[model samples]
Target: MADGVRPMLMRLRRNGVHVGVFLLGAWAWAGGLLPGLLEQWDDIAFLGWQHVELVALSGGAAILVGVPLGILFTRPRFRRAGDIALQVLNVGATIPTLAVLALSMGLLGIGNGSAIFALFVASLLPIVANTMAGLRAVPPPLLEAARGMGLSTRHTLFQVELPNSLFVIYTGIRTALAINVGTVPLAFLIGGGGLGELIFTGIALNELGIMLAGAIPTALLAVLVDFIMAQLQFWTIPRGVNPLR
Candidate 1:
């Protein structure tokens, strides 16, 4: 427990800027800088839930596709093709997410479907990249040891490679989810309902209170998502592989 607390404290120290921003936002709210927020409690709750659902669906799809695709890329059988695929994904990731969203809107013709597709695309590259890197980072000796112990190839992967690599994979998921939370607001442009409704509306009307109503919650959600994923990484990673342990 002390080990965990130490790391968390260190992290907070390193992230003082973030802590300060959060505190400042809280002060603003308490000071009634966002009076409109109090009146829109129901909208905030409803839209926040919608925002969470969008993130979950998109982030889940990215993981389902990215992790396996990453593993395939790491395999000797697919090495050459994987390199090409990685290049493509890297390039795709470089394209601004808004552009991806715009293209998705064009193809899918608006709504939640387009938003999900765009977010999934935006989130895939990191997961795939990290998975491949994590697998490769596993010491070669570990693979030999597993084989010498009579572990089958599949068994070696599930019992050895994946367990060891989960920390890095989870980092990728954490990053992707952060991006998802930030980007989901753009979905409002396509009629995909979320907290962005208040944000965009506030922007057009130049209403600071309305804007903060959406922006503050979005920022808080990003922090909350990262914290949750970090805790998951701490608990799920093998103690032998987890650096924090």
Candidate 2:
């Protein structure tokens, strides 16, 4: 019991920085720094809730599209089609979020749907690329074993191949998520709205409480999202895959 308690205490100390930061922020807020932040409570609310919805929809879309596409890479024809996917994902990853917003503004004219479109485009390549890599990484012998067992191609994939590749797919999704979190800042720019608005407004005003209030929550939200993704990886990937490795 003492040994376990010692390690747990050490971990608490390591992560205690968050508590200190939050306390400092609470102090500023109580002291009446950046009082104007209280005025925009509605904006913060809209930004937080809508951004959550936006990320959920966009991230789900990425997963559905990426997983199946990864499975498809097992086909002999994948090589032939790889170039098209590469080009599409290259465009997705390379385009700036602002440029995506501009294109959407020209076409969709700015709304949650427009925001989703931009995020979807931003999210695809990592999923597709990682899926392909994971499928390719399956040891050739394991595939042969599946074949020798007389499994159909589809069976081999759904059962043997996909499981082994799950870790890779999880990694891809997590990376895309981190990218999306960064993109949340742009949502404020486009009127997709989120905590980013609060942070940006606070920064513009140079109000310590407002800045801390807005910035702290955004940072915490990113951490929260990252934590959820970590949970997902643990649940979906087999233990042998070595998440860290």
Candidate 3:
């Protein structure tokens, strides 16, 4: 396994996933999968795309906020109160999601704003904790050597600590993205929009087509996100790091 071949294989695999998804989507649409799903045909085309967009919007925002906080909290200075930091983060994780949505209703006035906020909170803990963990997990000797070289704190973080610890951070994000897939459905409760609407509408009207329609897309979205994260993890890890060994 030469380094050169590894990247080529990864690229091929990446393309393979896209090919698989396209094939599956076509099969689902053509094989009456939508009809067998749940039933909201009043606007099937629009809603399908919207559900995917909702997942991306909510999850994407979580990454933007969570990654920075993760990077910030990884420093040694931040570790002293890691307990406090974790406790604050835990509060976000522990609060019943519905309560957060309810609170957001009063605070943000509903719609996507409120839903994104809740999803953001839900996705925060794993990433923040993992970032700090990754930073801490860096070999102490490495840190000492970097400091000995007169590397400034910022320089040390970016140049030395960040790269070595990135594996952990990526793992954290992958975990958070998985969590987001399930949690984003809560948005439907708030009228913020998502595939959950299909789940709800199906149960209410006993329409299998709509339910499958919604479920398939949400499931596909989760798998797609997971695949992307996996590729990222593999690509970013140093040439020889075993992804699963």
Per-candidate TM equals 0.88, 0.81, 0.78
Separate clash counts for every candidate = 0, 1, 11
The parts of candidate 3 lying over 4 Å away from their true place are: 1-44, 240-245
Give me the overall lDDT of model 2.
0.77
Native-to-model Cα distance after best TM-score fit, residue 188 in candidate 3, in Å: 1.3
* lDDT, candidate 1, 28-82, per-residue tens: 7788875668787888999999999999999999999999999999998999988
* lDDT score for candidate 3 against the true structure: 0.78
Query: How many Å off is the CA of 181 in candidate 2?
Result: 2.3
Which structure is stronger by lDDT: 1 or 2?
Answer: 1
Clash pairs detected, candidate 1: none
Per-residue lDDT of 51-131 in model 2, one digit per residue for the tens? Answer: 788788887898788778766755787776875676777767777878887787677876777778777767767988888
Weakest ten-residue segment in model 3 by summed lDDT: 34-43
- Worst ten-residue run, lDDT, model 1? 28-37
Candidate 2: 10-residue stretch with minimal lDDT:
33-42
Q: How many residue-pair clashes does candidate 1 contain?
A: 0
Assess candidate 1 and give its lDDT: 0.92
| Candidate 3 lDDT, 16-65, residue by residue in tens | 99999999978977987755653555545566566667667767887788
